[model samples]
Target chain A: MKELEDRIRRDGTIKPGNVLKVDAFLNHQCDVALFDAMGAHWAQLFAGRQIDKILTIEASGIGIACVAARHFGNVPVVFAKKTQSINLDGDQYVSSIYSFTKQREYPVIVAKRFLQAGEHVLLIDDFLAKGNALHGLIDICKHAGVIVEGIGIAIEKGFQEGGSKLRKEGYDVKSLAIVEKMDADTGNIEFATTD
Target chain B: MKELEDRIRRDGTIKPGNVLKVDAFLNHQCDVALFDAMGAHWAQLFAGRQIDKILTIEASGIGIACVAARHFGNVPVVFAKKTQSINLDGDQYVSSIYSFTKQREYPVIVAKRFLQAGEHVLLIDDFLAKGNALHGLIDICKHAGVIVEGIGIAIEKGFQEGGSKLRKEGYDVKSLAIVEKMDADTGNIEFATTD
Candidate 1:
């Protein structure tokens, strides 16, 4: 966790409108080694919990979740597709979410056969800001009749309501790096102290 | 390679219109253990090549490329974005491609900073049908002035022109399982014999 926090401090850029650009290492260009370490940290935090599958959204979360799946005993990682494709046929659990980054609302889809009833799932994502994406994934899990074991986030914006709201709703959320405050003009950032 | 061929024969489904769906383990719901094996196989095939980065497209390719990066000494995996986002700012290498699955023309974008001139890159993808997506990635690599050491593909539809075309272009292509023929009605699949 400290390694991730440090890496974010050194490489991450604070942009206008609270936009933290970590594309250099986090999302667009991925650091698989760091992802593996984050996965190990989550495995420790969620120890003793039954995680049958790792669920994530497509594009960004796919890489991190797949790399982390190794640490989770190579569980199947089901990435919810953001758009409907001809390949995506048959019954599916669908949930819609608005992405501020993409500036549009899109449907998150997962094939129904992949998620069975009573299966324990761990949700993983790159960032947790407004929590809309996480909420959409949670909605699909509910419809699929699966049990949510825990949520693993790479970075959480502490100033935002997403992380706190999820925690208050009785979700076990473990975010490796939480940005408490960030300055666009001075390019300064602060992280929440976690034990 | 035999292991991958065996898995595809076991879990891969053949749909109408020449659609071979391996979503059960390969793309939609990923089997990371199997992916690890595929990665090891590619590492063996593309061994001795100087690969500084792993380049791939978003959604499906990210997981395979990220997991495979470990076999390449944990190289950085850079996935080209399929859509424009507010997070994607500054200079970029852009190419357009038409997706048969999505039934639309989309832009393949890679940030200019991640790719450096003369850097050796290995292109990885989940499926190589018509090679439209792979071509887009290769176009960006060309514009960025990166050297493509090799191309690693999980599955290639040998009946399609993509794999053959890329091979004809003098690329070192290593496909784990090459589907020579498939029957949708009978659900029978055959792989091209390889040495």
Candidate 2:
């Protein structure tokens, strides 16, 4: 967690609209070595849980989920597709994610076959801000009668209510790095940890 | 490679239109342990090559690329975005991929900064059918002036011309499992030897 926070401080860029650009290492350009370390950390945190599958939303979450799946005993990873594709059959368990940045709700779907009843799924993602995307994944899992083991997040915006809200609900949510605040003028990223 | 071929034959569904759906293990429902083995195989094949990055297209390719990155020293993994998003910027190296399955040509973009000129890149993907997606990736690398060291594919339709064409052009393309012919009616899959 400390390493991730430090890496964010060193390389993360703060843009207007409260966006933190971590494309260099986290999402766009991935550091697989760091991800392996991240997977190890998550594996430790959620040890002893029955994680049958790794669930993540599309685009950014796919990369991290795939890497983390390696540590989770090579479980099957089912990523919810963010957009409609010919590959995605219309008969899907669909949920809407309200993207504040994009200013709309997009439908995320999963094939009925990929997710089965009574399966234990561990949700993974890059960032948890408004909790819309994570909530959407949870919805799909619920629709399939699956149990959510826990959530593994690369970064969480602590100032936002999503992380705390999920924690209050007694979900096993683990975030590698939590960003407390960021200054656009001074370009300083204040991390959440006391250290 | 033998194990992969066997798994495909057992789980892959041969549908109409020559579509071999191995979503159970290869793409949609990923077997991470198998991907680990495949990644190790790719690492061995491209050993000694100075690979600075692992480049792949999104959706299906992200799963394999993430696992393979671990074997390659956890090098950076960058995937080309298939759709326009707020996270995507204007300055991008873009290419058009004609998806015969989808019957459309969509723009695939990579952040201009993630890919740099003269970097050794290893292109990876889940399936190599027509080689159109691979060519799109290659085009992106060409636009950025990056050196493509080699390519690693999880499965190749040997009956198709994709693999042979790349090999003839002097590219070191290694497909973990190459299917000779897939019979939809009988559900038979023949694999090519590693040699």
What are the per-model C-alpha RMSD values against the true structure?
0.8, 2.0
Off by over 4 Å in 1: none
Give the CA lDDT, 0 to 100, for residue B68 in model 1.
92
lDDT of 2 at A104: 82
Once model 2 is optimally superposed onto the true structure by TM-score, how far is the C-alpha of residue A59 displaced, in angstroms?
Answer: 2.3
Q: Relative to the true structure, how large is the alpha-carbon lDDT of every model?
A: 0.94, 0.86
Q: DockQ of candidates 1 onward, in order?
A: 0.96, 0.65
TM-score, per-candidate, Cα-based: 0.99, 0.94
Estimate the lDDT of model 1: 0.94
- Candidate 2 lDDT over B1-195, as tens digits, reads 887888887888887677888877876677888888899989999989999999998878887898888888888899888877777765998889998766889888899999889999999999898899999999899999999999999889898998999888888899999988878888877888973
Per-residue lDDT of model 1, residues A1-195, tens digit only: 799999988999989999999998999999999999999999999999999999999889999999999888999999999989888999999999999999999999999999999999999999999999999999999999999999999999999999999999999999999999999999888999763
